[model samples]
Target chain A: MSLGCELSDLQLDALRELMNIGFGQAAAALSEVIDLRVILTVPKILVLKPEEVPAFIDAEVEMPSSFSMVEQFFFGHFEGTSFLLLPEEEGRKLASLFGAEAAPLPPELETGSLERETVVEIGNIIIGACVGKIAEILKDQVAFQAPRFIEAPVDRSSLERRLAGAKDLALVFKTVFHFERQDVFGFLFLVASEGSLEWMRAAVDEYLGSLA
Target chain B: MGFKVLIVDDSMVARLAIKGIVKDSVDSLAEASSGEAALDLLAGGREPDLVFLDLTMPGMGGIEALKAIRSGHPSVKVAVVTADIQARTLAEVRACGAYEVIRKPADRAAVLALVSRARGEGAAP
Candidate 1:
C-alpha cells in the first residue's frame, strides 16, 4: 500500500515538518562548510514503486545526458539509500567553488579525480547532516556507508537496476538545494526502505504525542 | 491575567508544538505562518506580549520581521525559534533585537520557562 493510504494528513504534515527541520540543519551545516547561504526547498515525500524513481528523476532534472550522483546508505530505525544528483554543468560549477581544477584525467585515474572527490565531500556533508538531525529528533541512532560517486549517464534501466534491492515500495524524500553565491542547484533524494515505513509512521506519532 | 503570545513559523507543526507548550500558561495565543504575516498581525493591532518567530521562511524572514517589530512595536518581545543554531545566526538575531532564541524541536520546560519569564517581565510596570 502507498504511504498516503497508510498515513493521515496530520501524520504526513508531521513528517514534512521533520524533514523541514532536518534540511534546515543540513543547510546550516553546508553553509558553514562552504561559507555560502544555502537555501533548501521544502522536502516532498512520495511513495513510489522502485521502478518509478528513474522516471521521476528524469522528469525533475530533464534527463541530462550525464549527471554526477553520490550514493550513500544509511541504516537505523530509518534505513535507506540517499542520492545527491547534479547535472554535469552544475557539478562542474560546484567543483569550481571548491577550487577544483578541471584537468583531464585518464579513465583509470578518474576514480580519484578532484571533481569526484569534491562532489563526494559535499554529498557526505549534506546527507550526514540531514539524516543525523532527523534521527536525533526521532531519538534513533544511524550509521552511514561511505558515499560513492557515479559519473555516468543515468538511464531508466540503469537506475532501476540500481534500485533492484529495494522492496515493494520506496518512500522518497526529495529536496532542492540552492547555493546563493554560485547559484548552484542540486537535488537530494532519500529513498527509505520498506522496512522503515512502519517505524517511520510510529516514530512520527511518538514525536507528535511528545509535543502534546 | 496572562500575557498574549504569538507563535510564528512556516511549519504548522512547529507552531502547534510551541502552542501546545504555552497555550495554558498564556492568556491568548495567535499563530502566523510567515514573518510578513506576523508583522501584519501586529500592524492590525494584535499586540502579543511575546512573539516566538522562526528564522527561515519564504519571504520577509525572521530577521527582517524582528527588526520591523522592534522598530514599530518596541514593547513586543520576540524570541526566535529556529533550527539554525549557528553562532552567526544567533548573534545576528540578538543584534536585531530578539529577546531570546529558542532552538527548534524546542524543549517543553525551556518554552515554559521562557513564557514564565516573559509573563513576569511583561507584568512589571
Candidate 2:
C-alpha cells in the first residue's frame, strides 16, 4: 500500500541500511548489558501518515492482544519514541533475566520500584543506545526521556501523547528482538515524530554520499 | 602559533569524538553544545582558528549559525558536519561560506586533512 511518503528509492535504501546500523548498535549494547548474545532485526520499515498509522499498526504490528511494554522518547536530531512490547510469557522470561517473576498485575509494581527499574533499564539501554549511536553517526545530539512501563490495550491518550500536534510524518520500523535459540515473543518499534521524515531524508542522502 | 579549534555539537560524545579527531593538531580546544552557545563564545572573544559545526541543533541550526558567523566573523573558518547531505543543501552551505562539508561518521584522517587544509601545513601545534 502506498503511504504517501516522499522518500526516493535511493533514500529508502539508505534508510534501510541506517536502520540496520541503528538497531545493530542497540542489539550490541543490549548484549553487553545482559551478558548474552542478543539479536535485533528489522523486518520492515514504513512511513505513514498519522491517519494511516492505526491500520498499519493493526495489520503489521499484530502484537499480542494483551501485553507488557516499555516505551521511551528520544529528542534532538530526530524526535521519536521507541517501544518494546512483549507477550505475557515473553515478558515474564525477560523480567526473569533481571530478577522479576511473572506477575498477575502490571509488569511493574510501582514507578521507581526495583521491578520497574529493571524494565526502565531495558528500555533505556535499547532506546538510548540506538538513538545515541544514530546521533553520534550523524554528529548530532539527541536526548532521551526516562522510560516508562506500559500495559497493552493502551489508552488512546498514551498513544496520542507520543507525537502530539506534530505536523509532519512518521517513520515506523518493526524490529524483531531475541536471544540465541530463545523464542522471545517481543517486538521493538521506532516511531519518529512529525518533521522527522525530512530530517531522515537528508540524513540518508548524506549517508549515501559518504559511502560514495 | 598552535591552532585553536571549537567543536559545536549537542552531544558530548560527538564533541569528544571530534576533539580526538583534531587533537594532534590542536593546541587549544573548546566545545559548545549548541550554535547559540558557539556564537556566545565567539561574542565573548573566544577566537578559534577553525570550528567544526554540527548542522542539526535545537535553537539555531548550523545553517543560520553559519550565515551569522560568515557575515559577522568572516575570518573564522567553519566546517559543516552533519548526516544530512544533498547537492542542493551542500551547495547552500558552501554558499553560506563553509570551508567544506564534512559528512558525518567522519574518520580521523578526514578530520585531520580538513584541519591541515584550514590551518595550513606546519601551522598546527
Candidate 3:
C-alpha cells in the first residue's frame, strides 16, 4: 500500500483486481460514447495523506484551467472526486464541432439550449462510468448528481480550503485517457473518511478472504 | 435558411456547449461523440454547414476527423472547440483547415458572438 496503512498480500491482490474491473468498465463506456476504441492505461493507484496529494500530478496543473468538469460522488464502499481534464485547445476544437468560428472563452456557453443539455450529458457519462465501475468493484450501489460545469479557472486556494475540511485521508489515482487519436488526460481522487477507512479495512479483509 | 451544424466531442457536456452557442443561428443540430462518429454522421449524408469538434478522445481524435471531413466534405466549415490549447494543437487545427478555435467553458455571450462570426454576421478577426 502506498499509504501508511498496510494490507495483507491477499487483500492487496483482491483490491487490485477489483480496481482493474472498475477501470475496464470505464474504458468501455468511453469507447462507446466516442465511437472509437478507447485505451485506458492501467491506473496508477496510490494511497496518500493529504500532504502528499500535490506530488501525484503535474505541479503546474494545480489550477486546471480550460473547459473541464468536476464531479463528486459517494457509494457505500468509497467516495470519489473525478476531474475530466480537456486540453485548452481541445475545448476550442469542440466548439468548432458546433460551428463556432472564433475561440470561445468561458463566458460564451449561455447562448443555446441544446449546448447546455449536451454539456451536462457528456459530464454525466464520463464521471458516471468511472465511479460506477469502482462501485461495482466494491459491490456497492452508486448514485450521481447532475454535472456541474466549471466555466472558470478553479482557484487553488478555494479547493485547498475545501479539502482541509475533510475528515479522512485521500487517495489519488491518475488515469490517462486517449480518445480518437487525441490525448485527453484526467485525474481521480478517492477520499475516505476516517470511519470509511475503517470500513474499508474490514471490506478488504473480506475480499481477500474470498480470493483465497 | 438557417445553417446546419455538427457537434463532436466525447463529453456530452462539450457537445451541448457547442449546440448552445450555435442554436440561434442554426436550424438543426446533429451530434457525434467522437471523431469516428462525426465522420459517420457525415457519411450518412448529413451535410453540416459548420462543425464543432474536440481534439482529444479515445479513438478517432479531432485531427483524424478534420482530415476525413476535408477529403469527404470539403464544403463544410469546421472549428476546433476544445481545452487543449497548446500551440502545437492550434497549429494542427490550422493545418486541418478548421474555420476557427473556441476555448472551453464557453459563456453565453461568447457562444453567441462566435457563432455570429462563424456565420459571417460578425467580423472573424
Candidate 4:
C-alpha cells in the first residue's frame, strides 16, 4: 500500500517555498549554536514511492561515514523526521569550536559531554526550523518532542534499513545543510504515509485559503 | 538592576558556554541537568529573573518544563535557548508563552541582548 499522497504542482510549489523558509530558520539556529555562518542549499523536494528512496540515496551522493543524530518530531497536521550528519573529521574541529575538554581522539567514543550537547542542540535547531516553517504554512499548532541525538556512524546500508521500514506509500523530501568552519554537511528528511499525505494536503490547502 | 539566570542543559560544557556569555552582563546564575531538577530548584525557593532552557533533553524536555514553569510561576520570563530553528517548533514554543526564543551556542553579546530584549529592553540585536 502507498504510504503518502503525491503532491500536485501547486502543492509542490507551496511546499517548496515553505520548506525554504523552514530551512532558513534552521540555518539561523545553526549560526547561533555553531557561532559561525551556516548556509543551506535550496531544498530539493521530491514525491516518490517508498521504493524510490534507495535509488535516490545511492545515486545522489555517497553517504558520508560519520556519526549522526537522527531526530523525530510530529506536529499538528504533519510529521517530520530529520537526520543531522556531521563529518567525522569535523568532529575534532567541533570539539574545539564548542570548547569541549576532551582529547582529539576518535569520534566513535571519544566524544565528551560538551560535544554531545553541541550535536543535540544542532539537531534540535534544524528540525525545529523546518517543522516551524511547515506549521506556519499550514496555520496549525503542533507539539514537538525534543531532538534525540544518537552517536553512531551512518552508512548507506543503515540508512537503507531505516527507509525500508517507512510506511507503505511515502512522500520523501530532502534538504542539504552546509556548515562553515568545519565543512559540516547534513540532510533533513520528511516522510509521510499515504493517509498522512492526504491529510497534509488538505491541511495545507486550508492554511493557504485562510491566508488568502 | 542585573538579574539572576538559571540554565538547564545536560551538557556541562554547554552550561559553561552559556555561563561565559551570561557572566559578561549578568552577575548571577545557576545550572541544572534536567527539567525536573530545574523545577526542584524553583520549588526549593530559588527564584531567578530569567531561565535559558534547552528544548531537547533526556527527560522532562523544554516544552514540558515551559508549561510547568509558567503554570507555577507566571511571573518568570523564559528564553528558549536551543539550536532547533524549525518554524513549527518556534510557533509552538511561542504558543507555550515563552518570553523569547534564542538559538543555542549564543555569543556573549547575543546572550546579553536576548535577555535584555526579553526583559523589555530597547530592542534585540
Candidate 5:
C-alpha cells in the first residue's frame, strides 16, 4: 500500500501548490486549443506503489471501451514516467471537437488529416504542458520521450506490465477537465525511482527553506 | 534614473507575457531563466531597479532568489509574479525583503502598477 513515500504535511502542501500551477497552466493551454472555457481540477493526489494503479482504476472507472493511453518518459537527474489515461470514446469526442474524424462516420477525417492529428496532438499538449511546467518549476533538465498513444480497451495486466518498476513509486494525480458542459476525466500518473523521490524531497525541502 | 528591470522565469511563455508589459516603461531589460541566473546577473553588475520573479522555477526558485537579491542588493526591489498567488510564501517573500507580489497571467497594467509601487513611482501599495 505504501511505497515509502513519506512526503510530510509541508511537502504535500508544497506539492499541491506546484501541481496547481502546472495543471492550471496546462488547462489554460487546452482551453485555447479547444476554444472553450475549460475548468481543470485536481481532486486527489496519491503517492502509491506501482501495482496499486490497476486496482484503483478498476474500482473507479466503469466503462471498459474508453481506454486510450499515452506514456511519456523523462530522464536525467530523475528517472520516471507520466501516463495520460482516458477513454477512447472520449478521445474521439475530443477529436470531433477539433473538426477531425472521430469514432463514427466522418468520411472527411483521414488518417493524416485533422482528425487523426487531433487524436495524437491532444496528448502532446496535455502531457507536454504539464511536464514542461513541472520541469520549469523544479529547474531540472528533463529529457522526455515522445508520447506513445495506445488505442485499446482498458486492461489491468497490460497496464501493470507497462508501468512496472519494482523500486519506483507512483504519484497518481486525479485530474478532470470540463469544457462547454463536457467532462473529460483522466489521470496524470507519475512514477519515479526511489532515489529520485529522495532527491525530490530534498529539493522541495530546499525550496521551502529558501522561502523561510 | 530610468527603470532597469530584470525578468526571471524559466518559461519563455511567461517571460514573453511579462516583457510585453514592461517594454514601454523599462527601456533597458534583463532576463534570467533560473534564480541563480538572476543572482549571477546581479553579481555580474547588471543592477535592475525592479525584478519580476517567478516562484516555482527549477534552478533557483523565486524565494531563494528573493533572499539572494535582497541580501546582496537590499536597495534593489523585487516583485514576485507567480501563479501560486495564494501560496504561504507570499508572507515570506515580503519578510525576505521583496517589494510586492503579483499574480500570474500578468498583463501590462497589473505589472505596471506593481512595478511602479516597487520603484516608488506610484503612491499606492
Candidate 6:
C-alpha cells in the first residue's frame, strides 16, 4: 500500500536541504575520526514505495563486487534505518588506514574482523551525525540501536528484507561521501519509515515557516 | 541605498532561507544553483556587493569560484556557506579570500550579522 502522502516541490526541496545539512555534519564528523578530508555529493531525497528502494539503491550505489554494509536503526518522531555501503576494496583500504595505532585489532582476529569493526565504527559516526543533525534541526530527538555489520553481496531480496517492518512507503535520502587523499568513498542512505510521513511534513513545514 | 546580494547554492531551500534572512536588508538579491551559474550571472552584468556561496556544489565548487571572483571581481565580497566545516576546508576558503564562512543549517543571527557587515553596518542585534 502507498503512504498516500505526496510532498510538494517546496517540501521536497526542504527535505533535500535537510539531508545536505545532515550529511554535511556526517562528513565533518568522519573527517575528524579518520583525519582525512571528507567531501559529499549534493544529497538527494526521494519518496518511494518500500519495495522499490532496493532497485533505486542498486542503480545509485554501483558496487562492482561484494560490499561491506552497516545498518543502524534510529528511533524517535523522525525514525529510520541508515545504511552505509562501501565497496569491498575501498572498505579494505579504509580499514587499513585505521592501522594498529588507530584501532588496534587483536592478533588473533579473524580474516575480515578489522574491516567489519572499521565499517561499524565509521557507520556509527556517519549515521549518528547525520540523523542527529536532522533531528536537532527539526526539533526532534532520536536514539540509535547498535550498528549491524553485513558482509554479503547486496541483492534485491536481501535489501527488501531490511525494510521488513517498514510498511506503506519510505523516504530515501541518498548521498556519496568522498574521502579525499585516500580515494575511498561510500554511499549513505537513510530510509525513513512510512510512519514518519505526517510528522516529517509537519516538521518541514514548521522549519520553512521559521525561515519565512 | 541598500547593498545588492547574491546567494549561490544547489539547494533551492538553502537559497530561500538565506534570501529570506537578507531580503529586507538588501536592495537586490539574485541566486544561482552552482559556482558556474554564479559566475555566469556576474558576467551577465549582475553585480552584488556580497555573494553567499556554498562549497560543495556539482561543478566548479566554491573554492574555484571564490578564486575566480577574486580575480575578476575583486570588489565583490564572497562568504562561504556550507556544511563542510573541516579545518582544512575552512583554512583554504579563507586563504582564497572568502569574506566569511557560515556553517550550514544556516543560523539566522549569524547570517544577518554577515549581511550587516556587508552593508557597512555593525553586527546585527
Query: What is the C-alpha local distance difference test score of each model?
Result: 0.79, 0.67, 0.60, 0.66, 0.71, 0.82
Off by over 4 Å in 2: A1-4, A61-64, A100-115, A152-166, B1-125
lDDT of 4 by residue, A52-155 (tens): 76566556656455455556666566754555555444444565666633346566654566567667776677677777767765766667777776666766
lDDT of 4 by residue, B1-125 (tens): 46779998755545665776667567588999889999999999887889988776666878899999988988888888775565656877899989887764355666777777756674754
Best model per DockQ? 6
User: What local lDDT score does residue B67 receive in model 6, on the 0 to 100 scale?
Assistant: 98
- What tens digits encode model 3's per-residue C-alpha lDDT throughout B2-121? 778888877554555566556667788889878887887888988888888776666876788888898889989888775544454567679889887776544567666767787778
A14-132: candidate 5 lDDT, tens digit per residue:
56556667776776666666666555443366777888878887777886634767777878565588788776666666766766323455687564354345656776776776666
| Candidate 5 deviant stretches above 4 angstroms | A100-116, B1-125
* Candidate 4's TM-score: 0.53
The ten-residue window of minimal lDDT in model 2 chain B covers: B82-91
List RMSD in Å for every model shown: 3.7, 16.3, 17.9, 17.2, 12.7, 2.4
Q: Which structure among the candidates has the greatest TM-score?
A: 6
Compared with the true structure, model 2 gives a TM-score of: 0.53
Q: Which scores better on TM-score, 1 or 6?
A: 6
Quality of model 3 by C-alpha lDDT = 0.60
Fnat for model 6 comes to 0.69
TM-score versus the correct structure, for each prediction:
0.86, 0.53, 0.50, 0.53, 0.62, 0.92
- Tell me the tens digit of each residue's lDDT in model 2 across B9-103: 76554565677677778799999988899999999998788989877555788888999888878899999876444344567789999987787
The window of 10 residues in a row where model 3 chain A has the poorest summed lDDT is A93-102
Instruction: Name model 6 segments beyond 4 Å from true.
Output: A1-5, A61-65, A100-105, B123-125
Give the per-residue lDDT of model 5 (tens digit) for B50-87.
88888766656678889888889988888888764433
Which lDDT tens digits does candidate 6 get at residues A23-122?
A: 7777777777778878777876787777887777678756554568899999999888888877777678888776633745568986488778888998
Error of 3 at A13 (Å): 5.1
Scoring each candidate complex against the real one, what DockQ results? 0.46, 0.02, 0.01, 0.04, 0.05, 0.75
The DockQ value obtained for model 4 is 0.04
Candidate 1: stretches off by over 4 Å: A62-65, A100-112, B121-125
